[model samples]
Target: MTGWLVRDAVAGGLAGAIVGGAPSTLHALLTGRDPLAASYAAGRMVLPSEQRPARLLAAAVLAHGALSLGWAVPIAAATPPRRAALFGAAAGLAVAALDLGVVGRRIPAIRALPQGAQVADHVAYGVVVALVCARRRVRRG
Candidate 1:
C-alpha cells in the first residue's frame, strides 16, 4: 500500500509539473512576463534582483508540483481508472474554487493571477494528472 501510494504520487507530480507549468508559462511568455517571476509572485516569495533565475524557476515548479501530487492521491484512491479524467475535471474545479475563492483571498501571490488564467491552469493540472495515472495503472495491470 505504501509503495503503491508513493509510485502514484511520483507519477502525478511529474505529470503535474509538465501540465500545470506549460500553460501558465506560455501565458506568461505571450504576455511578456517571465514565468519564473510569476511563479515567485504566486508563492509570495520576494524576488530580489540578486536571486538566481534557475533557483526561482525551480521554486515555482516545486510549489505547483507538490500541490499536484497531493491532489492526485484522492483521485487515485476513489475514482475508477477509466473515469479518472472526468473526476479530474471536477477536481480541477474544486481546486479553482479553493484557490480563487478561498486561498487567493488569503494569499496575495495567488490572487495576482488573472482569474481566467488560474482556472485554465488548474484544469490542465487535473486532466494531465488523470491521464498519467490511468496510463500508469493500465501499464502495470
Candidate 2:
C-alpha cells in the first residue's frame, strides 16, 4: 500500500509538472513574455535576491518538483477510482483557489503572474495527478 502510494505520487508529480506547466508556458511564449517567468518566481521563494539565471533555473526546477510531489500525495490519496477526472478537476479548482487566490496574494512574484494561466496550470496538475493514481490502481488490480 505504501509502495503504491509512493509510486502514484512520484509518477503523478512528474507527469503533472510537464502537463501542468504547458498552459502558462505557451501563454508566455505567445504573449512574448518570459516562458519561465513562473519558474523564476518560484525560485525566488528560496533565493529572493539571487540574480544568476542558471542558479534561478536550478532552484525553480527543484522547488517546482518538490511542490508537485507534495501536492500529489493528498490528491492521490483522496481521488476515487471511479470519476477520477471529475474529482481531479474539482480538486484542481480548490487548489487553484488556495494557491492563487490566497497564497499568491501574499507573494508578490506569484501574485504578478497571469491568473488565468496559473489556474489552468493548477487544474492540469490536479487532473494529471488523479489520473495517474487511478491508472495505477487499475494496473495493480
Against the hidden reference, what TM-scores do the models get?
Answer: 0.78, 0.94
What's model 1's overall lDDT?
Answer: 0.69
Clashes of each: 0, 0
Q: Clashing residue pairs in candidate 1, if any?
A: none
Which regions of candidate 1 deviate over 4 angstroms?
Answer: 45-58
Q: Per-residue alpha-carbon lDDT of model 1 for 1-141, expressed as tens digits?
A: 467767875787577657775777788888987666557755444333425666666666666666777777875655467777787778777877886788676666666766677787787777777777777777778
Model 2 poorest 10 in a row by lDDT: 44-53
Write model 2 residue lDDT over 47-120, tens digit each, in one string. 77887888888998998899889888889889898999888888888989987888778878888999999998
Question: Pairing residues by index, what is the TM-score of model 1?
Answer: 0.78
The global C-alpha lDDT for each of the candidates, from Candidate 1 onward, is 0.69, 0.88
TM-score of 2: 0.94
Best TM-score goes to which candidate?
A: 2
